[model samples]
Structures are given as structure tokens and as C-alpha cells.
Target: MNFKHMTAAAVFAGLIAGCNVMGTPLPDPRLSGRDAEFMALAPQARVNSQFERYLVDYKTNEPVGSIIVDNNAKFLYYVMPGGKAVRYGVATGQDAMAFTGRAYVGGMQEWPRWIPPKDMLERWPHLQPTADAGGLPGGPDNPLGSRALYLYQDGKDTLYRIHGTNEPDKIGQAVSSGCIRMRDIDAIDLYNRVKVGTKVVVL
Candidate 1:
């Protein structure tokens, strides 16, 4: 096997070994820096076992670098070679606001500034004051958290994104306006993995 395949095998083995052992908790694959300060400040949430990253027996026609959002399952799968995928928990849009169909990752940003969309401003008029003053700066209080992957279709901005959130507790629930939400650490991990032009399928 090539280097990539060998690396995947090692990761898969580690994941399998991490399952349900009665000792220390498995190291979270998503958290890069293990920032204790950030963890202390971030909202605490109980992450279900299914939401954690694992080596899944995913069979898909899509090539590597594709993303599949299973809305019903509240899971996001990043397709990998060798019939494997890295699954993550995601919070999707509410029933009427959920996005379906296909798009591609058009752009990416780190600690992105959030400009509240016009519709959002109309829905939450209270934000109009901030809307008048440019946009929210990137920080722990910013809704966009640490990373963002902008979605597009036919090279036009879809105004949807997969991004990190300040409120990590909302993950695994349908609470977003239209974009997908992930834990800040998970978002950072995914941001490092994917590139612009990655295909995304929302189902």
C-alpha cells in the first residue's frame, strides 16, 4: 500500500482500539491543540458516541475529498479511499430551512468575520444595529467560530457554509438557519483536511 493508505490503516486501527475501553478516555481526533483554556470557556455538551469520529464501512461512488451530509442521520461523512470515511456530528438547518441537493466548497477561511445575511437581519431585527456597523469580528463570541467552508453552485455563492460555532451544545440538533454547524475543534480538523472545489452532497 502507498503512504496515504498506510496512514489510513493506522488511523483506523487506532479508532477501533479506542472503542469502549474502561480506562482513560480516548483522545479526541478532532481537537488539534487540546486547548484547555478554550475548553474551559466553550459551552460544554455531551457528545454521543455515534457523533465521535470512527472508521466506518462506507461504500460510495464518490471519490475521495467528497462530503456527504446525511440530514436525517445528523451526520457528515468525509469520503476517504478504501471504502472508509471520517464521520462527524453536525447540526443542520431547521425543518423548513434545510438545504438539499449539491454544492461545492468554493472558499475557506480561518477565524472568518460573519456578515449577517439580509434575511437573517430581517428575521432578527435586533441584529440590525450590528449589521449597520459592518459585521461581527472573528473571536470566541463570533458565531462563525474558527473555520468556515463556503458553499457554492455553478460558481455562484449559495450563501451556505459548513462552519464552527461558539455554541457547541447545539451540535447534533437541527437548529441552524441554513448552514451546517460543527464543534470548533472538529471544524478546525475538517478545515485542514478539505480544499476548495470539494464536492458536497446534502441528503
Candidate 2:
């Protein structure tokens, strides 16, 4: 077996085991520095078993190191070198607001600041104060959570992001203005693996 598959094989059992275990308290991820500072104060939520992180056989034509977001399935997959993927449950944009098509990761940040777009402020006027204030500062309370991957298309900002969310319980559901939301742990994991210019497909 190739090195990638060999690594996948080594972790497959453990990840699957993680997906099946229930009623047991999930352990906090080992984080350091700023990550530790925020997550320690971030509200903890119980993620359902099926939505928990997992490793599974994945067959796709996309090249290795690509990302695929399946909104209907409420999962985001990072394609591994082998025919395998690490899947993480996500909360996607609502039907009308969902973004579909291809984009590239243009930028990334840890604990990114969130500026409510004009459209979002129009939809919820209560957010006007936040927009006036130049956006919320990055921290535990920020909806962008602990990490964010800014999406761009044709050298222009897509005005969308694949970002971490403070609300972990919202995973496996379709309920967001437009940005794709992931749990902090999953976001940090994905951020570590992806880089600027990474391809992403939303379906």
C-alpha cells in the first residue's frame, strides 16, 4: 500500500470508533496559545454522533488536497492522497442564500474578525450597530470561531467563507446566511491541512 493509504488505514479504525461511541463525554482537543485561550472560554456543545469527525472511503475525481462541500449532506470533505477523506459535519447556508460553484482559498486567519455584510445588516437591522462599529473583534464570541478560510473566485472576493462557528450544535443543519460553518476543532484541523489557493467546490 502507498504511504497515504497506509496512514489512512492506521487511523480508520480509531476514527470510526469515534463515530460510534455514545453517551461518553467527548474530550477537549489539545490546543495551545491563542487557540487554548479562546476555546477554554468558548461554549461547549454536544455534537451528535453522526456529525462527529470521521475517516471514510471516498471516491472522487477531484485531485487530492481539494475540498468538497455537500450542503445537502451537511458535510465537508478534505480529499486525501488516497481514496480516503476526513469528513466533518457542517452547517451550511440556507437554500436561497447558499453559494454553489467553485472557488479558491485566497486567505486565512486564526480567530478572524467578522464584519456583517451590508446585505446581512439589511436583513437584520439589529446588526447595524455592529456594522457601524467596524465589525466584531475576533474572540470566543465571534461567529467566525477559531479559524476562517476566505474564498475567492476569478481574483475577486466571493464574499463567502468556510469558517469555524461558536455554535457547534448547529452542525448537520442548513441554517446560515451564506458562509459555511464548522466546529472549532474541525476548523483548526482543516486550516492546518489547507493553504492559500486550495480548491474548493460547493455542491
Candidate 3:
């Protein structure tokens, strides 16, 4: 594969894991110092960050077919037919998260385990101790947080995930290693709404 394709695949693959359990959480990243001040305004302010809206339009009220991620708006929409979409606030992948195409929801899980990556272990020697220590239990601190939706295409793993995050403040920003993240509550809500084999469009 050429650089663009390779880059895209790597980006999607990193997102697939959603969160890192063995490594330390990355530092908060805002677009600018002004963005930092905006974050400091309060949790409500963070949650209420301005984001563009796009309503779904079609035949049925149920979102039976596809999931769309509007990266710029920091919103994930499950497209239901008949002019309806379930929108969720999201935290996106940082420098590495850049999947621009189609994939399928191959599997879904609740309170999933987390295994740190080799590079993460290399970066943080402490992670080496936990590399073989097994997956972390699900709960407040688990990187994967509450839920995970794995993305796959053509019978292969795409390595991108739309999962829940513990940090509600991180929504609408780029911070994670490379995952389409959502608040725990919102994730559970979306989790209940989606199923295996759903179509996912990450652009």
C-alpha cells in the first residue's frame, strides 16, 4: 500500500483499541490557550461547546443502517430513517486518528478489557510490567470505560473503535491516542441502540 492508504489503515487501527489500559492517560490537548480557558469555564461549558447539527432524513424512525462521525463537529450520528438521528457528544483521536472511509460494526462489548500496545510499553517502561498482566477490569478507571464498538471491514479488523470515555470534559476535543470516544452515559445509550453488523462511516 502507498503512504496514504497505509496512513489511513494505521490511523483506523489505533482507534480500534479505543483506549489504553496499561499506559498513562495522555495529557489534555486544546486547540489553543483560548481553548484551555474555555475548558476551564466549567463542565457545563465544556458539554455545551458549539457544534453544528445535521438531522437525519429518510423513511423509518429507527436507525437501522449506518453510523456517521462528523469529526469537525465532534458528533456521532446514528442515522435513523425519516428525518431522525441520535446524536452523541464525542472525544476524538488526536494526531493519529484519521480514518476517512467506510467500515462495519463487527462486534460490541460492555466493560471490555484493555491490553496496552507494544509502543506504549516502550514509551512508558511501567507498562512493560503490565503488558503480560492481562486486561484491566471494567469500571470508572478502565480506559475503555463502559463500552466499545469494534470496527471491521472485508473480514478484517480496521482497528478503529467508537467507545465510551470516563472523561466527559474531553468530549468535542482531540486527546485520545486514536479512538472515536464518547461519554460513558452516552456510550451506554448508543450501545443499547446499535448492534453487530451495523454500517459505520468514519470521515
lDDT (CA) for every model shown? Answer: 0.82, 0.88, 0.67
Q: How close is every model to the real structure, measured as TM-score?
A: 0.81, 0.86, 0.68
The sequence of per-residue lDDT tens digits that candidate 1 reaches over residues 1-203 is 24465677787777667663322222454443534445446665677767756557688988898999998888898887888777888999999989999999999998788989998988999998787888997766779887899999999999999998898778889999989998877887788889999999999
Model 3, residue 161: distance off in Å is: 1.3
Model 2 TM-score on a 0 to 1 scale? 0.86
Leading candidate by TM-score: 2
- TM-score-superior candidate, 1 or 3: 1
**Candidate 2: clashing pairs of residues:** none
User: 61, model 3: CA deviation in Å?
Assistant: 15
Where model 1 places Cα greater than 4 Å from the true spot, the runs are 1-40
How well does candidate 3 match the true structure in TM-score terms? 0.68
Model 2 residue 76 distance off true place after TM-score fit, in angstroms: 0.3
Q: How far is each candidate from the true structure, as Cα RMSD in Å?
A: 8.6, 7.7, 16.6
For model 2, what is the C-alpha lDDT against the true structure?
A: 0.88
